[model samples]
Every structure is written in structure tokens, then in C-alpha cells.
Target chain A: MNNVYLRNSVRFILLILLQVLVLDNINFRGYLNPYIYIMFILLLPFETPDWFILVSSFLVGFGVDLFSNTMGMHTAASVFIGFCRPGVLRFISSTRDYEQGMTPSIRDLGISWFLKYSIIIVLLHHIVFFYLEVFSFHEFFYTFWRVIISTIFTVIFIVIGQYLFYKKK
Target chain B: MRQLFRFLFKYYFFFLFVLLEVFAFIMIANNNYYQGGRMLNTANQLTGSIYQSYNNIFDYFNLKETNRQLAAENALLHAQNENSYVKITNKLFKVQDTTYKQQYQYVDAKVISSSTGKRNNYLMLNKGFEQGVRNDMAVVSPIGIVGIVNGVSNNFCSVMSLLHSEMKITAKIKKNNYLGTVVWEGGSYKTGTLLDIPSHVVISKGDTVITSGHSLDFPEGIPIGTVSYFKINQGDNTYKINITFFTDYKKLDYVYIVRNLFKEEQLKMKGVQHE
Candidate 1:
């Protein structure tokens, strides 16, 4: 339990710092900013307390918001994902049960399962986030394009990060 | 009452989620409407210090480009210097400093962080209220205008960049003195739209657009951009002009925040006119 807490705490700070200090600053043709900090929420232990998920997601999201100056969009999206995480875990795990100390990562689950889980979570987060940023349906297709492109970019980075970091463990 | 307690205990997580979402929504609404939610912006103490330290590390990489720009500006200033010109007609031309009252004062600031891709983009400056920075002041680069100060903290301030959707500038065509409004319509950072110029104004490609002295925020005749493309709006007897901004907002590092010394007097005059 102590090991789990230490790992998550380190991951949370490192991810948020990498996000605001590095990824957010890279203006790729004015649009493609991939958010990999959601991976922190995704990799939390399967048995983390429900309220803890909600609160930690809020904290992480708010941390990003405070740095990037997007006040509430991140918090709203992250909280929504946290609320839906249990259902997503259950939906994906109908056949196989999560063993003790299992996390939703490429290391714990195979690539296919992790990809499916992350794609859904990232899609949901981006849909809520990009729309909130745009705040208007007038340019619906434009915003939709942003959401799709950013979601793809985010998923790719999250997968790459998982492989790179979880190599030794 | 026992059943109620049991129900609440069983579903506390859902209620917490709802409560958190409502709070987040409130923040979004407030940020969108007020435009000055001071406590949540990067200009605050914690985030500002972090960005400052980050800038301290990365600022060296930009030194070469920054030096080149400063040298160019210095050459221009040198050419315009009084000592650079010989007195053509030396007839006791005593120049008095008191002859002209200063109407605008500029404070130099470095851009610690900025973004141009977002729908509503903003730049954060290292200077703030303690350094005489105030909200609504005009931020301009050596090449052209940059943004307007939106929120100010003790040691930092956030600028609403010219690329923002809500930004509007009163602009004039230099040759013909035609007035219009410059606005960003959610596309490229380098281009903006000039509105309210009449269709029959005979404007052509390469016409220079400059800031008009209508707003207290900016002094008159600051270079905004030049007309890149234009067409008559058949629906409304106006010209739809596209301008390429002179200031490259993506590479902007240093800016001058303009303080209108006569702002109070201008407001007082407006109040008199209203009566």
C-alpha cells in the first residue's frame, strides 16, 4: 500500500510538470497539443477508493489548469472520466478479473486491452474538453477536427510513455 | 431517517462527482464571462514563480534571436536620433523639453509564457501591478501591437493576445484615412480581418493598416499589419479585408505595456460630452 502511494504521488507530480512545462509549450502548427497527464488517472490501482479517484482527478486536472490558464475545462473533463472509470473497467473486464495490485497499464494488461481502455477514456476527455474550450457549436466541424486529432496524438504519447517508463518494472 | 442515511452513505461518490462538476462548470462560466478571474490565472503567485523559473532555464536559447531584434530596433532609433541629423537651418532653434507633455509611458516586460493556438489566447508577462502594469493597457512589440493586459497580480500579469477571438482594434488605412475594426476570426495567428471599411474605398493589395487614436488603450498610428486580401461584402456595403500582422506572436519575447497618462482626463471629457 505504501509503495502504491509513493509511486502515484511521484507519477502525479512528474506528469503534471511534464505536461505544463513541455507538451503544452510545443505549438505544433497551432493545434496538436497532446495531454498525457490523463495516463496518471488511468494507471491508478483498480481498487483505489472511489472518492479518492474523484478528488485526485480533480487535483491533477486543476494542477494543469492553474499552469495553462484553462481554468475549468480540464477539471470538468477529468472528473467526468473519474466518474466513468469504474464502469469502463467493469465493461472491459467481463471475462477476466483484475488480480490484486493490477493497474490499467500496458504492463498489467496487454497492449490491446490497454489501448481499448485508453482510447475510450481519452476520447471522452477530449470531447468534453475541446467543446468546452470552443464553447460554441457554430464551428462544429472545426472543433470536432481538433478533438479527433488531439485525441489521436494524446493516445499515441500515452502509449509511448507507458512502454518507456514501465520497461524495468 | 435511518433509510435516508443509508441511501446517502451508499451513494456519496455520485454526489461528490455532481458537486465537483457543478463547481467546475461555475469556474468555466465565470472565466468565460468575467475575463478576470484573478485567483485561477497563471499570473498568480505559485504558477507565476514556476513559469519564471522555467523561463530562467530556457531563456538562454532565445538570446541570439532576441539580440538580433534589439540590434535592428537600435539601428532604427539611431537613424532617428537628433544628433544623427545636421542642423540644416541653424537659426537659434532652441529645443525645449517642456514644449511637449508626455501622453504615454511604456514599461518594458519579458513574455514568460504565451500561447497562440487556443481560441482565446493569452500571454503572461513577468511584470505586474508592483511594476505599474494595469489591466487594459496595450502591449506592443517593436514590430507591432501584441495584446492587451487582462489580469494583473503582484509580480505578473496575463495579456489577452491580439489573436484572441474577443480582441478588437480600431484600425485605419494609412493612405486614404479609412477607419475599420481589426479582429481575429479563429484562423491563422498571422492574419486578422479588417471590418467597417466601405466597399468603394479603392483599397488595393499592400495597403498599410494602422491603429486609430480612438481607444485610450493604444496611441494612434501604431503599425498593425498590411492588407493581404480584400473583397467587397455584397450583403453589407463593407469591405472584407484580410491583413497579415507584423508582429509574429509565436516568436514574441519582449513587449512594451503602454500606460495612457491622459486616461483620466479622456474619461472626464467623455463624461462631460455625455451630459
Candidate 2:
């Protein structure tokens, strides 16, 4: 009914479509593929309800699992990041407070804060995702490289996407 | 009850996260045994149609390569056609009848979606039950064997590729006649490992591997790969051999689904014997 809600809804559809149709096709060396859909979860307003964040993250994860055949790896990773989100945000903005209706972007939260915020969350998400996908620590280094490399790629996409779509307050 | 309700109310978001994560864990556990669930897989009609629509546009770019592959295949088939048969004089009068009974039939399909960058890779084909693609059907490209059909919807099917961790393909070294199981470790879609061949079996680099015909999914002698490198485990009597698969999964587009006409009869008879 409201502007924010309308924008978020449109974002959800567009992100899902882009992820399943376009981004999923990018096979980079058969590994280190970037998952840009998680940016949708990353870009929600700072003050969005915690329950809404977790629930929507789970839903988006399931939606991604449907197209990618990942079972629930995406959902689990998304929910894990969603759980850590508030803590990370609190830790980052220990000094300045976030304004209402403001999304966490470079423009809204400065370059340094946005970098720290996105990096921690993206790394956490990738760790959860790669570990769950393997479900083993036997290939520790292999999974570790996958997590690190994919996290870098995912973070780059998320950052670029934020600048491209959202503007400064 | 009051204290519990207060605690629950206080940490409802955390609890919600836990609940959702548990659901994800359950789905993952189930998929640990099966690659994808029947309910959620993209093989279903709706997801399949979405991929089909995208692939409709995407296929045009690869049309030239696809046509060349098809044309090459057509030339091969033409060279081997019944019409190309030559009448040869035998000691007896007849050598033309029933030389090879049709053991396998093929249903042509296009890959609507395929992923090579996962522990378990899956391919979704545009053909399904309507096209006579049933579960466990063998999917092969013009270059080599691809995968086995895992699940099927009305218009699409999901294939558990040879590159999947859960997939164990029965393959044999063509030169040495040693059989082994092919399994994929995560990360690299370019190569896979063949397990269970005895150490004493003499093998060499570039030794061709083919399907063993042990499973109904594939016929005997389909090209699996060539041995890349191998080493015998010090403790065990078996050798772990690496294979470079013939099919380039990243470039896969068109595939033929092998539909066995006698599979039902064979399975039924086997069931009777077991019973």
C-alpha cells in the first residue's frame, strides 16, 4: 500500500527473475560464481522489522533453491545472515544512528561503514552457503577458497548494485 | 506459562530464525539422500516453463553450433542407414535379416537449464512425460553420455549429471576391461574420479573409459572419458583414477534421452524372481 512496500515488492520479483534467469547462467570456471540475489536481502531498510527480515530471507532462499536445485542451502545461509544482521548493524553504527526509511547504502552510511557492513554479512553468508553445500569439512581448503572467492564476487555485485539502484539521502 | 510466554515474546525473531534454519536443515538432510525434493525442484511445470521461455531467447545465440552438431550427426546417421546397406554374397542365401534388434530408442530434448558449479550438478530438460521421458532415463549428448533422469514433470525433467557428488556411474577401462565407479568431488566440473578398479590391472594414460551397461540408465560402451592420471592407494588394493569426461557440461545444449522399450518387462521379471 505504501511506497517502500511497493518498491520492496517490485525488487523481490526483479531480483528473483534476474537471479534464476540471468545470473544463474554465469558459469565462472565452474566455480566462484557470484550470487547477486542476496543483495535483495542486503538492501532492505535499516529499520525493517527483524521478523520480516528473517522470514523474507527464508522465503527468498527457498525461491532460489527452487531454480538452482540447492535444496535449502540458500535459505539456511540467508536466514543465518538475517540473524546476524542486527548485531552487525549495531556493531557498525555504534556511533551514528540510522534514520528511519533509510537503506544501508554507501550514500546513507558512508563508504567505510557500508564496506564493513557488506563484507561481514557477505562473508558470513558465503561461509554458511559453501559449508552447507558440501556438508563436510573434509575438503576444507576447497570449500574455503570457494567461500572467499564467491564472497568477494558477491560483495562486488552487491556494492555495484546498491550504487546503481539506490541513491544518496 | 507466563514466564515462558514472556521469553518467547522477547526473542520471537531469534526463535523464528531457528525454526526456519531447522526447516532448511531438514530439507538439506532429505536432499542428502536425494539430490532434490519432488515438491521443490525446478523440474516442475511452472519453473520449467520459466526456464524454457528464457532458453527460447538464449538458444538463438548458440543456433549455429547446434545446427553444425546436428548436421554432423545427421551425416553420421545417413552413412549408417539401412538404405546404405550393401547386398553381399554369402555362402548361404541370407545375411540381411535381424542383424541388430533395436535395443534403445532416443527422444530428443533441449537443456533448458544446467549448472556446473555445485557439489551436485543438475540439468533441466525441456522434454518430460509428454515426450516419454520417464525417471532413470539415460540422457546423452552427441559427444557422450550426460546424466540420468532423476525427476520428471509434465513438460520437463531433472537430470543428475555425472558431475554430481551423489552420482556413481559404472564405467570400465576399454583396454584393460577393469570396471570402476565414477564419483565427482566438489569444485571442478572438468574432471571426476573413477573408483574400485583393482591395482593389479595394468592401465595407461589416455585409456578410454565407457559405460559398463550394469545399470538400465545407459547402454554398454558409451564414452565416459579417458584416464587422466591414477595412483594406487598404499593401504588398499584399488586404484583411484581421474577421468576427463567427454561431454563439456558448460556448452551442453541438445541431448537425447534413451528410452528402453524392454525395461519394464525386465524389471517385472526380476521382481518376480526375487519374489
Candidate 3:
């Protein structure tokens, strides 16, 4: 239990730093701003309480908002994903249930399962984030394009991070 | 009472989610204004110092580029100095001083953090209220116009960059003095659209766009950009003119916060006129 707490705390701080300090600065043609910090929420332990997940998501999102000056856009998206996480997990787990102490990482689950899980949540999060940031239907198609492109890039970075950090035993 | 307690226990997570979302929505709505809640932005004390320290570490990498830009700007200033010109008109010297009583002042600042990819982009500077940086002051780079200061803390200020979707700059064609508004359409940081100029005004591909001094934010004749291309949408009277911005927002390191000394007086005059 202590180990899990220590590991997650380290991940929280490091991910925020990597996000605001490095990832946010990459211009990538102004449309491919990938957000990998959501990975922190995705990889939480399966048995973590629902309320705890939602609260943690809010804090993580608020941290990103503070550094990037997005105010509440990230917070809304993160809380939405936090609410959706359990449903997404149950839907994906229809074929096989998750065991005790398992996480939603590529190492704990297969690469394919992890990809599906992240893509759904990330798609939902980016939709909320970009739409809120733009805050208008005036440029609907343009904002939608940004959401799609950013989602693709974000998922790619998450997968790369999973492989690089959480090596299989 | 037991039934109510059971129901609350069962649906607690949903209620929590709803509460958090509502709070987030309120923040979003509040942040839409030019002056929103001040505690959450980078201008606040904690984030400002964090960004400043981060900039301290990375600022060394860009020394060469910054030096080149500073040198070029210094050369321009040197050319404009009184020493650069001989006593061509000693008779008009005293009159010139009397006629021009310093309407604008500039405070130099370093950009600690900025973002251009977002639809509403902003830049955070190391100077703030302590440096006389105030809301609505114009920020300009050596190359062209940058933005306006919207939020300020004790030691830091945040600027709404020219790349933001909501930003509007009053501009004029240098050749004919035709006025228009420059706005970003949310894609490229290097270009913006010039609106409200009539199609019959005979615009060329390379005509210079400059600030018209219609507002108190900027001085007249500051270079904005040059016309890249333009067209009329069949039934419209105005040309859809696109101009490439002179300021490369990505490479901005140093900027000048332009304070209009007569701004309060001008605003007071306008207020009186309304009556």
C-alpha cells in the first residue's frame, strides 16, 4: 500500500512537470498539442475509490490549468473522464474481468486493451477541452479537426510513455 | 430518514461529479472576460516564480538569438538618436520640444512563458504592477505589435497575444491611410486578417499595414504587417485582406510594454462626450 502511494505521488508531480515544462511548449504546427498527463488518471489502481479518482482528476486538471492558464477547461474535461472511467473499464472488461491490484497500464493489460481504453477517454477529454477552449460553434469543423489531431497525438505519446516507463515483467 | 440516508450513500459519487462539473463551468464562464479571477493564472505569485525559475534555467540557451535582436534594435535606435543628425534646423528645435510632450513611455520586460498553439494565446512577462505595467497597455516587439496586458500581479503580468482569436488591432494602409481592423482567424501565428477596408481602395500585395492610433493602446505609425493576399467574396464591399504579421511570436523573448501617458485623460474626455 505504501509503495503504491509513493509511486503514484511521484508520477503525479513528474507528469505535471513533463506536461507544463516540455509538452505544452511543443508547437507542432499549432494543432497537435498532445496531452499525456491524462495517463496519470488512466494508470491508477483498479480498487482506488471512485470519489478519490474524481478528486485526484480535479487536482491534476487544476494543476495543468494553472500552468497553462486554461482556467477550468481541463478541470471539466478531467472530471468528465474521471466520471466515465469506471463505465469505460466495465464496458471493456465484459470479455474478462480485472483481477485484484491490477492497473490500466499496457504492462498490466495487453497493449490492445490499453489502447482502446485510452483512446475512448482521451477522445472524450479532448472533445470537452478543445470545445470549451474555443467556446463557439462558429468554427465547429475547425475545432473538431483540432480535437481529432490532438487526440491522435496524445494517444501516441501515452503509448510511448507506457512502453518507456512501465516495462513488462 | 433511514431511506434518505441510504439514497444519499448510494448516489454520492454522482452528486460529487455534478458538483465538480458545475464548479468548473462557473470558472470557465468567469474566465471568458478580459479580467477574470486573478488567483488561478500564471500572473499569480507561485506560478509566476516557478515560470521565472524555469525561464532562468532555459534562458541561457537563447542568448545568441536574443543578442542579435537586441543589437539590431540598438542600431535602429542609434540611427534615430539626436546625435545621428546634424543641426539641420536650429530654428525649429525649441518648437519641436514644446509641441511633443512625451505621450508614450515604454518599459522593457522579458517573456517568461507564452503559448501560441492555443486558440486564445497569452504571454507572461517578468515585469508586473511593480514595474508600472497595467491592464490595457500595449505590448510590442522589436519587429511589430505583440499584444496588450490584461492581468497583472505584483511581479508578473500576462499579455493577450496578437494570435488570440478575440484580439482586434486597429490598422491602416500606410500608402493611402485607409483604416481597418486586424484579427487572427485561429490557424497560423504568422498571419492575420484585415477587415473593414473597401474593395475599391486599390490594395497591392505588399502594402504596409500600420497602427492608426485610433485607440489609446498603441501609438500611430507602428508597423503591423504587410499585405500577403486579398479577395472579395462576390457580393461584399470589403476586401478580405490577409497580411503576414511582422512579429514572429514564437521567437519573442523581449518586449516593450507601451503605456499611453494620456490614456486616463482621453478616457475622461470620451466619458464627458457621452453626456
The lDDT leader among the candidates is 3
What is the Cα root-mean-square deviation between model 2 and the actual structure? 2.8
Off by over 4 Å in 2: A167-169, B29-32, B35-40, B82-100, B200-202, B235-237, B268-275
Q: Write the per-residue lDDT of candidate 3 for residues B1-275, one digit (tens) a residue.
A: 99999998899999999999998988777765664435325578888899899999988999999999999999999999989998877676554444558999999999989998999999999998889988889999988899988888888999999888878989999999999999999887888999999988998999999999998889998899999999985787999999998998888899999999999999999999999
How do the candidates rank by TM-score, highest first?
Answer: 3, 1, 2
Per-candidate DockQ versus the true complex?
Answer: 0.63, 0.67, 0.74
Give a tens-digit lDDT track for model 1, residues B1-275.
99998998899999999999998998777765435645335679999998899999988999999999999999999999998998788878887767678999989999988987777888899999999988888999988989899899999999989988788999999999999999998767889999999988999999999999899889998999999999998899999999999999889988899999999999899999999
For candidate 2, report its TM-score: 0.90
> Could you tell me which residue pairs clash in candidate 1?
none
lDDT of 3 at A50: 100
lDDT per residue for candidate 2 within B52-142, as digits (tens), equals 8888998999999999999988998899998998868656785556676787999999999998887778899988888887888899998
Per-model CA lDDT versus the true structure: 0.89, 0.84, 0.90
Q: Which runs of model 1 end up more than 4 angstroms from their true locations? A: A94-96, B31-41, B86-98
By lDDT: ranked, best first: 3, 1, 2
Expressed as tens digits, the lDDT of each residue in A30-90 for candidate 1 is 6677989999899999989999999999999999988887888899999999999988988
By DockQ, the best candidate is: 3
Residue pairs in clash, model 2? none
- Model 1 scores a TM of 0.93
